[model samples]
Target chain A: MIEQFFPNVNWDTMFEATYETVYMTAISVAITAVLGILLGLLLFLTSKGNIWENRGVYAITSVLVNIFRSIPFIILIVLLIPFTRFLLDTIRGANAALPALIIGAAPFYARMVEIALREIDKGVIEAARSMGASMTTIIFKVLLAESKPALVSGITVTAIALVGYTAMAGVIGAGGLGNLAFLDGFQRSRDDVTLAATIIILLIVFVIQFIGDFFTNRLDKR
Target chain B: MITISNAKKLFKTKNGSLTAVDDVSLTIKEGEIFGVIGYSGAGKSTLIRMLNGLELPTSGTVDVNGKVISGISSGELRKARQKISMIFQHFNLLWSRTVRENISFPLEIAGVRKNTREKKVEELIKLVGLDGRGDAYPSQLSGGQKQRVGIARALANDPEVLLCDEATSALDPQTTDSILELLVDINKRLGLTIVLITHEMHVIRKICHRVAVMEEGRVVELGNVLDIFKQPKEPITKRFVQQVTEPEETKETIEHLLNDYEDGLVVKLAFVGESAEQPLITTLIRSFNINVNILQGKISHTQNGAYGTLFLHLRGDVPEVKQAVEYLEKASVGVEVITND
Candidate 1:
């Protein structure tokens, strides 16, 4: 009965596809976290009424982030092919899929990070400054530490969005569950393979959401 | 220890330029608790912020211990701020940190060693009366407890001067008193110069050695607390003084007193310092043979001495009442005849 419900579903290929998906999502999310946080901090510090506010830096960065965020993930993958080939020496497979996945998701994540940082109390920053804390100290000890829960939630949202983008990366011969569903299931009219892929993606998203909720609840002091 | 000369801060808003602090020059002596009292938007906050270089003045100089704070390098201003710690009205504590970590922040900023930081934080925890609550976060504590953490953190670097920016306005009456008492104790023990800004005159009366009444970015009146309370020069100052000294709601009580006792002379006598303890009424009745009926009276004490106001209904002839008024005036007691029938 199970074979009847999931016809021609190769278990070994499914496992390889699932591993590729997790690997691509994990690496892309990690890279986006570091780069997006830096970009977000730059945006926040250079915004008007902030301590390190600068109009020129803020305007340029703001426009770049907006331009990147407005591009759809599928088109972003196609558009970043040349840059991906330049960086990775090829524009196929999971490794080549990385640049597009990270670039497509990082700007979106940076906006979320900016919003999270903005939620921190201005008084807390002032208090840190009044204590003679250096700019580095204030950034790490006050701004980042104070807004940890919000930042964690933002990361979770960005990670889930990356899952969708990684699935889209399968369009250009990137090997993941999405590739399995697109090449073998959708093109060959195998509904069982497509159903299995959908189930696995939902499971991954659920796990990410659960972990995000757990940390947010545990870390929130306010 | 601190001097502000012609310090002004002009903020350019969307409408136009708004003067937050204007040509305010004042000196705060060492080991004295000075207060700046003003209503909201009177620039008292901006004035106190300039002392610590948190808000730099537009054109003038702010000198703390002979260091020119305004327009100095950021690093130099930060170093100067370490010697001049500040506590805020909202406490401004790091919500994510425990009480101990919050107090240890400045010590950490100064790069004190781990063991030394622990010992100092322990001592400060006890000093602020937090005791076993050091492991608690700010969200778990009451308003008073959060302010105690603020106080302990401000004292972490053993600052020579403490700037309190509306430190007790957010607290209730009882909490405000406890915090005021703590400030007084800290002032005495460390001889730390505290410059506090508040809209409450009672706060000024409780601990401030000297006060400057600010209005519309200007120090309208400035004097010792005792002198300011006893003889308020400005109209706004008199209203503030009346809040503390005249407890029975000054205007309505006087109206009621005048309504009831319209036959005899209703004299309002103000007493300050030693005059508050004098037996002027007894001497007048004994010597002048006039009957005295006390109407309404309230006496309050400031840091300096006793200050009070009393309404007396003297049933006597015109000449005798005139003589009693003259006697009070000669004795340095302020006499104001409210209603003379």
Candidate 2:
């Protein structure tokens, strides 16, 4: 009964593809969250009127983040191929897709993180400083803690975008649901296979959004 | 105790340099509520921020509790800041944290143990009059309650000096009075030196032992709250004193009274300190042969003493009125003849 409506759908391959997509999105999103936050903090701290105001450092970081964020995701993946090969020794598998996926999403997420940090009340940071909080403490306890809801929602948006990037990476031989849809479904004229992969990807996106919204709502005391 | 000697703060903007605080020198004694009163951008905020090194002076020194705040290293400054806490106009409590957690933040920053932090937080919650609401978020609290949380947070590390940067300006009149009372209570109970900056003269009159009036980045007038109210030399200081001393309709009422009673001389009398407590009005009625008609009066109680102004219409023979004026002048009260002009 299950196979009647979708005769061309290979459940085992579909499961493997789904796992690969989830694995890539998960690893890349985790790394992106960390790297993005660090970069964002640097950007925010060095900007005008911030704690560590430095015009030169702020300009350089701002330029770099802007450049990376402006590049098209597919073009970013292609440009990072050589760097990915050097880092991972090959650029074909899910593991190889990570470098490009993170590099593409981190700058985007870094801007989001910077916006989140900016949304925090300046008085809160000043109050923490007046309390003798060190730079590290302000970063972790005040800035990060105060902006937790924003940061969570920001990474959620970034995570969903990363899922799409993973599928695009699959088009370039990084095996995922995208790879199954393109190589086995599209190239082979299997509409059922493409439909199944699309349904699963939508499900993954829905789950990511559900989890993100949950934490965002739970964390936002404001 | 804090001493700001010849302190100056200048900000370099894109257009030019702006002097926020200019060569201001003052000493705040221990266990006293010192207030800096000024309109916005008059450098009062910059002046208070200098106490905790939140804003470093362009030159000169700020000495707080024996530590030179201006000349200290960042590490040393941070260490010194642990003993100098500040609350803000916005009641800047971290919304992510509950009242209890917010109060515990400074203790956490001071590296207190978890058990001690918890105990200190509970004590502060009670101290700020937010006992049952300790678990509530800042957003759940009213403006007054949020400020209480801010005060509790400032008191967490047992700071020797508490700086209030327009702390009660965000609150309503009733809430402002409550917060001011709490500040006075803290100053007396903990013996904490409080340095507060406000545009409201009522705040200074209520809690401050000493008041400094700032105008255009300079300390225009500095004296005891009662003295400043009694004899405000500077124009800005006089304006501030009038805020609490005279109501908006006092001038109109005086003019109206002047027109209504053409035969009497309307005189404005200022009573300060012990003289305010004296029965001068009753004495004038008994000693002088004149019709003493009280027009309007207001008394403001400062931490030092009471300062008030009374308007009276003295009617009778011109010579008798003259005698009454002389008699009133002989007393400690300040006498001024009010004319239609």
Candidate 3:
């Protein structure tokens, strides 16, 4: 009965698409995590009343984040096609879809990181300053450590968003479940194949969310 | 070893400008426990922050250990802060870290070697009476235990000065006494100059050698703790003094005594230091032909000395009562005639 319903569902192609989806999500999320954390830290330290307050750096980074966050993901993919070609010398597969995914997601994640850092108590920061801690020490030991659980939660949310973005990358012929579900299942009128792909995508999102919550709960000492 | 000369702070709020710390000057000697007491928004917080260079004074200068802390560059101010540490009412401990890690934080920031840091943290844990609870996070500890961690962390660098910003305000009365005892112990052992900012008069009375009473943005009264308790000049200082003496109840009690004993003089007497513990009431009866009846009395200790107040009923001839009152006054006791019935 299963074979009759999913006659067009090639297991080998489905597995390959699954691999591509994970690959694109992993690489892009990894890049976005590092760049986003740095961008977020810059925004935090240079905020108007922080210990390292610098108006110029704060204003510039805030505008940059706002501009990138304003663009729709589909338009962003098309917009970065020329730059993707220039960077990777190709614009055809999972790897080629990465530049746009990272550029689009990192700024979104940076905003999350900023909110996480801001949630730290002002008194805690003053306590560190009173102890003669340097800016570097505060950022690493106090601010980052205190915000760890929140940062993990932020990263989890970002990772889930990146998963969706990678599937959307199918518009550029990126070989993920999105491409398979859109062209092979939907275009071919194989509604059963589309339903199977949808189930798998839902399962991936649940897994990511579950892992994020587990880590957040374990790390939150407060 | 700290001096402030006409220090002031102005904050630019949405409404024009507000003076947080009005022009004020103070000098704190080494090994002295100086207290600043004020209600909220009275500039006590700003005054304490200025000593550690956390808040820069808009004018005047703050000199600590021969260094001008006000208006200094961030790097220089940070270096100065190494010799001065502070604790908070909330404890302000890093919730993610264990007690030992929190204590070692300053040592780590100062770049003390790992082995030395471990040794120092262990010593501090014992010093603050944490002992086997070193591995416990702040969330697991009680309020008193958290403040112990705060004290240990503040003392990690063996700082010359420890500033306490409403350190006991969040504590219960019993816990506050324990913390105050711990502070007094640390003060004596290390001879560290402690500047305590509190709105609680019991805190000032129990540990401070001298106190500055702040109102609005100015120092309304500054004197030795015993003196402030015995002879408070400002209305704010008098209210603070009443916190320790229970003056409101005493006043009612005095009225009750006055009504009951209509033929005697109702007198209120205050004694300072050794005079409070003296057998002066007996001496008044022995030396003069007067029958003295005690109405209300209490004796409490300050870091400087003991202070006491007494309400007395003198039922003797009016001439003998007047002589007894003069005799008590001559002995350097503070005497006030509440009523001459």
Each prediction's total of clashing residue pairs, residues at least 3 apart in sequence or on different chains, is 0, 0, 0
User: How would you class the docking of model 2?
Assistant: high
Return the lDDT, model 2, position B335: 95
Docking class of 3: medium
lDDT of each: 0.90, 0.92, 0.91
Please give the range of 10 consecutive residues that has the lowest summed lDDT in model 2 chain A: A1-10
Off by over 4 Å in 2: none
TM-score of each: 0.97, 0.98, 0.95
Tens digits of per-residue lDDT for model 2, A1-222: 979978999899999999999999999999999999999999999988998899999999889989988888889889999999899999999999999899889999999999999999998998888888899999999999999999999999999999999999999999999999999999999999999999999999999999999999999999
Best by lDDT: 2
Model 2 chain B worst lDDT run, 10 consecutive residues: B255-264
Error of 3 at A192 (Å): 3.0
Give the candidate number with the greatest DockQ.
Answer: 2
Give the per-residue lDDT digits (tens) of candidate 2, residues B1-341.
78889999999999999999999999999998999999999999888989988899999899999999999898999999999999999998899999888998888888999998888888888898997998899999999999999999888888999999999998999999999999999989999999999999999999999999999999989988888888899988989988998899988998998888788799999998888889898889998889998878988888998888999989999999999999999997999999997
lDDT of 1 by residue, B31-129 (tens): 999999999999999999998888989989999988898967998888888999999999999989999999999999999999999999999999889
Q: RMSD to the native, candidate 1?
A: 1.5
For model 1, how does the per-residue alpha-carbon lDDT over A1-222 read when each residue is reduced to its tens digit? 878889789878988999999999999999999889999999999999998899999999999999999998888888888898899899989999999888887888888888988998898898889888999999999988988998899999999988888888997889899999999889999989999888999999999999999999999999
